[model samples]
Target: MAETVTPAVGDTPAPASTRRERTGWYVYDWANSAFQTTVITVFLGPFLTTVAELAAGCELGADSCAGYVYPLGIKVAAGSYYPYLISLSVFLTVFVLPVIGAVADRTTHKKRLLGAAAFTGAGATIAMAFVTGDRYLLGGALFLVANISFGAAIVVYNSFLPQLGGPDERDGISSRGWALGYLGGGLLLALNLAAITMLSEDDNPQRTLDLARWSIVSAGVWWAAFTLVPLRWLREHPTAAALAGGGGNVLTDGFRQLGRTLREIKAYPLTLFFLLAFLVYNDGIQTVITLASQYGTKELRLEQGNLIITILLVQFLAFGGALSLGALARRIGAWKTVLLSLVLWTAVIVAAFRLPAEAPLPFMALGAAIGLVLGGSQALSRSLFSQLIPTGKEGEYYGFYEISDKGTSWLGPLAFGLVFQLTNSYRVGLVSLLIFFVVGFLLLLAVPIRRAVVAAGNTPPRVL
Candidate 1:
């Protein structure tokens, strides 16, 4: 199992070689990440909770808020709105992205599908501007739609990876995309933060909420505008003509192909092992990104402005961090660097439990640490996984990859929400994420990377 996977050398039709095509693909990352940073990481979670608290008529910061009933007869603490909404979103996407992936593989409208997903998501994000007081249900609905779209778009976006570069070129190229994402996300967040500061009145929660709504609109605009780059330029291999021959039923053929791919995956035990490990650790990562602001605000009593600044700091740091870690991967091997990053993740969670409430600087320091590893770890994992994908089945295989990515996203938030509900302590919930990293770390160790590569008909990178 420890032996590296090294398939015999075989020629693959090289991906598009033009610089414009490559740059167009990278720009899509720059586009969608605005939603990831401004909406998911920085603003929407805390803002929605505030809205839910108002909707439920719960007195601010009261234990009785736990008794407040949401739209679906769902009783959750005022603090529970964002995490619960995200949990629901991730649960749905677990099923959706794989199907989207399968279809993208069978169709030639990959760019069109990508555009539809992005615009639909942007529309949802823009609608968040209408989510005012007592509009928790509306906000939740939009979040669900936007999140599902986000997950679906990412499926198609990631599937393009194997078409963009060969196995040897994937690590650097993937890192560049993530770094671009950080830069784009960070830039929008900075402007949004500044806008929120200028427009939001310190004493007026409602006014602050209004400004936050506009910020959401701005992020959507940024996402839609930048998305046009990839939509116009990133070409897909011709598959549309073959669609007529496949029983003229894209859905049935997609399902059939997906079934075959699922069965095929059983023969690649190491790939399965890696997916399981990724499912666990990436959940921890996603949960932290999703909930960190909420925990900082609701539990630690940090100011929104300080938290926004911290998020901005993370975005900038992560840009460099992705590049740095990619270079580090070249030196130490991606597996070892990824494991090291997981250790740091575990440490961050541990540090989170002990972080003193109302200490913005300390929280920001912890955020900086998270920033340093977050992009690096995720980027490397994507590239490493790319090396193990069976040729010509990139879309279907990456579909399973995304399923692994988003499927487990449900567990972390649900656990965080449930733990917070039971004990009314965010610290306890934060500590619970440690199990993911630890378990993932152990599972990662058991993976025979070299064997996985060879079994999937890939050559293991020399560094690995």
Candidate 2:
């Protein structure tokens, strides 16, 4: 396996031509976020749960199916299946993302890997139209493939950030990407929501199913169509002749390098500390993203229309929030800004726990608060870690970063699920998230950013 390397951070001037090329790279986020918004976050979760119940041959209202009682002894419906499917998807991504990221870096074919993943995801999304009663397994399978591709493509996309921006420019560029993503995602989701409302009737199950399928296909088509912008604009880095001299395979090298990096972490204490902080806090972030809708539906008893509207508000607010945060970071520094966001997150989670079931306004207020911090925290964290990576191993180190982002995500969700399962209350689950925020905030405070960047630059190279 090839070892992960960071690009040099000196004031090496990027060519004017290269700067021109970077514009198109931002468009990829615009293109791909449609899938994230429509398929993963808003539309699909509810649709899948609805479909799963239909597949299980359970009536709209039933006490049990397949001998399993509903946790709350409420009606056993298709909605019950969605959480399990999402859990399975999360589990698969944890194991697959690191390997996929490593392979893309070692091969110096990040673009190709990204393209392949995108196409696979798109195909699976399109195939969702075939899902029907007794086809829950098929729907689950497609979701698995689509989500894995989404995660893998993200690794490749993030790797391009270093090529586009230096330490001075990275925060702005990262913020721009995230903001653009929110705009693109929100626009498409709004269109899909409109289509569903206009084309489907309340009592027409087949028509509703068709509308759902079209929404899924729209995400795939949107992703594939928009990807061309980045495909045409970005350039891959030149591989070193000496490093390429042997019959060394990039895939084999990637794994070897990953192992070596794991062992070398003790020498980079600050980097280690940042990674731990990221792991903990990001777990909370991922849990919120995954479970927010479920919480609205199950605990708050929100109507579908209200839930969709709240999500749409989140998308637009996230755009403004991310850009404003970039400006704020410039004034006070990224680390402090992130700590403040974590504090806000803790407060919001506590508020969510206290929100009454009938209070839709407070729930929307909660969504607005989430929008303000979500984009800034994630975008700045990516840029911050980009500064810490050693030159030449961007892919390898990011592989580990992806592991932190995706791998440890299970902790938050698992804890949330367990708490909900035991207490039959999401309030307990929401309160437990405070622990992750507090721990991650303390760990992040311990990292010395200046020393870590210098040490990462000075570290000696090694063959994986």
Candidate 3:
């Protein structure tokens, strides 16, 4: 397993899109990341949680104020409401993105779908400005629309990878996309923090809440405005199926195509196994990210200032880290680079489990390390997946890929919660994440990547 999977390298190169078009692709990442960083990461959950708590008739910081809020007449702990919304959004995307992907592959309308989904999400996100006191239902419904549209847009976005660059170029391009995304997200977040700080005065509680609401609006505007860059640059390259002229209704045919692909997919075991490994490990990665602030605050009692700085550090460092890892992948193959990253991921978990209270410096160092590996592993995974998708089926496969790629899968957090409940130790629960990396590593190690490329009717890249 230690030996690299290097196949014969005499095949003709894959046709890559022009450099300008590739830049357009990168800008889309830059655009959407505003939503990820601003709404999803910084403001929405906390704001909405506070709202839910109000609905439950409890002050947020009150001791012994464990209470429930009902959304759509269903009982939910106020604290758990955000997680439920996230789980619901992710679950819906499992059905939505795949069908969207299947449709994109069969039509000449990929670019339209991308713009439509992006704008639809941005519109819904903009409407989040209206989600104030006792509007938890409005917030939840808007998020479901925003998040599912986000994933649908991403499926179409990811399918462009194979066409945007040759296998040799994908690692670099994907890295740049993630790097730019981090930069974009970080910049907007900094401005947002500044606006929130300047406008929020002591004793003006209403003003403070208003600032948060407006920041949500700014993120939506940013997302919608930046999306034009990609839509302007990307010309649709119709799929073979598109040119073949089936004349069938796209929605109906898309699902039919989806059903067919499911039945036919088993023959590509290498790709299936890779996806399984991805689902497991990526879930761990996302769960760790989602829970870190809670762990730092509840377990370590770190100040809010410390957490903010640590998060911003990861954002900037991940930009450079993604590019560096892509360069490394060029030299030592993407597959092995990812395996190395998993080892680093495991080390981060070990350090986290042993972290002591009130140690901001150590915690910041951990953030730096997580930053170094986060974008690299994720960007490479997307590029590597491009190699294993059967030609003419890129959209559908990447749809499946999106389910595992983003903020969707919630099972890892579910497991993490269960472990914490059983042991009553955050450290023990954190360490339990090791199982995902370990299983993913073993599964990835067993994959014959070069053989998988050939099996997918692809010419193996020079490195892998």
Local distance difference test, per candidate? 0.82, 0.72, 0.81
Tell me the spans in candidate 3 whose CA falls farther than 4 Å from its real position: 1-9, 61-65, 202-209, 294-305, 356-359, 417-432
Question: For model 2, how does the per-residue alpha-carbon lDDT over 344-399 read when each residue is reduced to its tens digit?
Answer: 98898888888999678988988999999988988888888887776666666666
Clashes of 1: 4
Best-matching candidate per TM-score = 1
Q: Write the per-residue lDDT of candidate 3 for residues 1-464, one digit (tens) a residue.
A: 12211222457455546767888889999999888777776567556666777789986444223568877788777656776777777788888888999999988888999999999999999999888877788988998998889889999999988887666777888999999998998788788777766676766645655676787788889999999999998768878987774788877888988999999999899998888888888877876776676577656767545665777788899999999999999999999999999999999999998888999999999999999999999999999999999988999998988886666666766665556545655677788788988888888888999999889988788896
Which lDDT tens digits does candidate 1 get at residues 219-257? 899999999999887777744433453556766777777
**In angstroms, how far off is 300's CA in candidate 2?**
1.7
Worst ten-residue run, lDDT, model 3?
Answer: 1-10
Model 2 scores worst on lDDT over the 10 consecutive residues at 60-69
Error of 1 at 67 (Å): 4.2
- Error at 355, model 1, angstroms: 0.8
Residue 104 displacement (Å), model 2: 2.6
Better of 1 and 2 by TM-score: 1
* TM-score, one value per model: 0.94, 0.87, 0.92
TM-score of decoy 1: 0.94
lDDT value for model 1: 0.82
Model 2 TM: 0.87
